[model samples]
Target: MRKDVVPVSSPSPLPPLSPPAGPPPCPPARRVSLPAARPVRLVLCLSPVLLAGCWALADRPVASEGASRLAAADPGWLLAGAALTCLTWVAAACVRQGSLPDKLPPGLLLASQFAAGAANHVLPGGLGAHAVTLRFLRARGVPLDRATASIGLYSLARSVTRTLVLLAFLAACPARRRLGELVPDGPVPVPAAAVAGGALAVAGVLLTVVPPVRRPVTGLVRAALADARAVHGRPCRVLALWGGSAAMPLVQAGTLVCVGTSLGLGLPWEQVVLAHLAAGTAVGAVPAPGGLAVDAALVWTLVSFGAVPAVAAATVIGHRVLNDWLPLLPGALTLSALIRARAL
Candidate 1:
């Protein structure tokens, strides 16, 4: 019997199917120890308390003296001075804004200025504030060249405007024209020339000696000039930059004037204001951070104008306590917050 040839179609072998790769073995988890992060967290939590405790222990005597002086002072005038002091923050914020082309969070900007006052007291020559602002704008994505240029503009405008304001006040107010009384009775020209010449020589020597910094110096010069041109192109920016700078000194002096009056400082009002301007100008180049030089200068100037020494000291102390000392802690905390947010 011939078996019919049967074609057996072997079932086609099934194509191999593989399961989806499970997340490629998740390269071993980073073994982050909680201990590593705790110390930082702990420090952040405790810094304020420690700072306050140290300040309290150190400043009790000064605080007592200041409190006594303020207690006896005219509350109305002191209050007005404080109110004006607050306005100075607003003015500072305005100046900072004018320095940058990009708009920043207004609340943060205002807070920065307030915080900057603390920095001014802590660091020499406004370096602390400058550092904070530079960092802030950099975080905001501003170009380094432009941010640096803004700083230059702010500084130049502040110095130049201050001088202009001082001159204008002396010219318009004949009462203040007696600013010559500030100098001792001698030929001022010789000493003045000597000082100027000495300063110029020192600056020239430094620039000549430091060749490496010249590259940045050159770039900064160009950037500053460019920013100046850009600012002039916008009238609002011009006003904010110059106007805010111009008003800053006046408001600051006004605080001193108010404090002096509250404590019965016996000088013409213009004389008090002029005294503040003159003293600040004199010690401005000194690296005395905060108001150390300035406070002494104010006290001396008031004494020269026939105010009682104790009373003058009290006024200076009171003003310092209000503007510089009181706000430090909160300002520091604000600075810390900004830093954490990467806005500083």
Candidate 2:
């Protein structure tokens, strides 16, 4: 009846209907890219800063004398430094093997160490070397937990020994005692003991809070206690291995002192120990490859605090040339050989 009353207007043109809107869509998640290796670029960025720092510190008249002293350093000292590095490797292997099974073999340990050292020098934070060591041990059928425990134990043993040496030196020296007082109740009186206690406390906290660290810490504790038991049975081997590892840092400190002497700067043994330990620790914590720029700055700063700026600069410079760069050659060669031999 309605259709009869209305003119057929194309089915009365259906009223416009709006499509229902769904919930607003979320933004797509962004992806992050991994960092790329750029060794040459990193070196370029760091080298200029190192050179400038050295130059700025070398401005004093004392620099001339330091230059002369550097020229006259006994070649014997250089030989001794190299020997110390060798001893370090041997001690490292011994420590590694001590925590591992008897069937793992010493050769693999040494190869792993050499490879790791090379990686440390070339890569940031020496993580590359650490990774290599981890993978190598893993390939040898070492469980991750055991490998982690062994590495931690060896490192802890070395650090404890080195810290004790520095503490002894600090206690024996008056200048260091005075310097310690200057920093508003600083680590002045007993640097080593204080640092060790601090490290233990920090590690204890880390074990309690961090899941990754907890497992490793517990494993390490067990391994170390077991090692203590074994040492009680064969105290000689443990002592020799750890003792040798511990001595390596002393050799390093002695070398730094010799460098100071060669620069005609009578930096005390205590100060020298302070410089080496402080600088080495700081640099090792940095992410830079072998802490190139950071290490140089740290060494310069430590020595300068106790000596003429010129002498400090010269000492750092000469030490780098004599110690750091000199070792790089052999380390590089060893790395190449290991690579070619497929030992790494």
TM-scores for every predicted model? 0.81, 0.61
After best superposition, candidate 2 residue 339: deviation in angstroms?
3.8
lDDT of 1 by residue, 1-344 (tens): 89899998989999899878786656878978888687896576455445555665776898789878888899999998988899898888889888766677889888878767766655688887888788878888888888988987888888998888778777766655455576777787898799999998987787778887667777877887877787778878888888999999999999988988898878777877877887887777678776677878778877876788998889889988777667777777777677566676
State how far residue 335 of model 2 sits from its true place (Å): 2.8
For candidate 2, give the lDDT: 0.62
Worst 10 residues of 2 by lDDT: 47-56
C-alpha RMSD of each candidate structure in angstroms: 5.3, 12.9
Error of 1 at 10 (Å): 22
Give lDDT per model, in order. Answer: 0.79, 0.62
C-alpha positional error of residue 103 in candidate 1 after TM-score superposition, expressed in Å: 2.2
**Model 1 lDDT, residue 266, Cα:** 80
**Candidate 2 runs further than 4 Å off:** 1-74, 101-108, 181-233, 281-284, 292-305
